[model samples]
Target chain A: MAQKQINGTTIDVNDEGYMTNHSQWNKVIAATIAEEEGITLTPAHWRVLDFIDHDFQEKGVVPGMRRMNKVGGIPTKDLYELFPNGPIKKAAKISGYPKPASCV
Target chain B: MTGSQPISKVSIVVSRGSLEGIYPGLIMANGARMEGIEANLFFTFFGLYGVLKNYNDKIRVATVGNPAMRVPSAKGLPMPTLLGAIPGMSAIATWMMNKEMEKIDIPPIPEFLEMIHDAGAGIYACKATVDMFHLTKDDFIPQMDKVLTVGEFYEQSAGGQIIFT
Candidate 1:
């Protein structure tokens, strides 16, 4: 575990810089993390993150990319376009969720 | 941490059409794309069964002559090769494997290929095999990028790990 400064607040993070404590997350922190991944937050980006929130709150685990596309109402291509390389990992990090355990 | 830069690219060659053979290569290529690694799939010989339009659904596990064939319902107990030669045993094995995978929500071969393609992985069919099998471009899933020669595969695979299965 590591502590990272995002939006001037110290937060718990993992070795990969993914936030470990969801309670410490906020929109500003998300935007800051997304910035480090070379992306700026957009409504489209929030849509994906919102999907993640709803799913995580209900399931207690981050949804896989397939479920994100099939159930989250976002196509895989659009997801890749929004988050670019390693969309699932990047989006999960920005959404203040742990790194996904999915291999898909 | 291994004193080498994290892998940035990968090229996978799959030459097996059986369920046991093709899935590992597909999984690795998909995993590469999921990690932001540049990735592509090169299908030659029987591996083309995975990419070809006519054969994907026909891909089955080989029960005969497979040393590791087992009775899945019996906790990995090995099955005799002679029993493996029973008619329809191959289909049974494939069905069981698919059932097991679906428990984890893994998609079928064709849909998995589409997912990999959507992840920005290049899916290629081998030109020599296509010619030998007399397969036209129309005979493959629309997701296939191109029919590549061995030279082109090597060219695309350059600067990264080349995994052959």
Candidate 2:
């Protein structure tokens, strides 16, 4: 674990750069972290983040790619385009949650 | 993110037709794409059954001659080989396996292929095996990208880690 100051706010991040504390997550921090990953947050990107948070609130677990496709209504192809590279990992990093663990 | 990527891609070879044999390759291919690594599945020999539209779902667990067939609750008791050799035992085992997998969020054969392909992994059938089995592209599911010859498969998998299951 480590401390990061993003947009003048102190936040805690894990070894892989994911936010360890959900309370410190905000739009500014999310964007900053995403910038490090070479992503520019678009409306499509925010849509996924919002869906992820909404799903997390209801499911109590970070939705994996399968869940995002089946329940969150975002196809894996589009999610890949929106977050590029590893969409699951990138989305979790920007959304301030531990990466989802899944094989489906 | 790490300083450098170690495994950028993987080439998985599936040669077994049984439910147990096919799933490991599918799971690995799916896991590869989930991590943003390029992945391709090569279905050869009896493994071709996994992608066949008429055969994929019909595949069952290999119980006969399988040394691992044993009772769980009873502990260390061999599920008598003759019992496994019975007509419906393999089906029963396959059903039990599917139920357990569902509880952990694993999709069924056809649906799992869709998920893997939708995640940008390439699914292919081996050409030699196709010829030996007298099968055509029409026999395969829509998710299969193409049927590749051994040489072509090797060329396509250039620079990727190769695994067999």
Comparing only chain B with the true structure, the TM-scores of all models are 0.95, 0.93
The C-alpha stretches of model 2 lying farther than 4 A from their native spots are B1-5, B72-76
Model 1 stretches with alpha carbons more than 4 Å out: none
TM-score of each: 0.94, 0.93
Per residue, candidate 1 scores C-alpha lDDT tens digits across B95-121 of 888998877767789989998998899
Candidate 2, residue A7: the lDDT equals 69
Estimate, for each residue in A12-57, the C-alpha lDDT of model 1 and write its tens digit: 9988998888999999999999999999999999999999999999
Candidate 2 docking class? medium
The per-model DockQ list reads 0.75, 0.65
lDDT of 1 at A34: 95
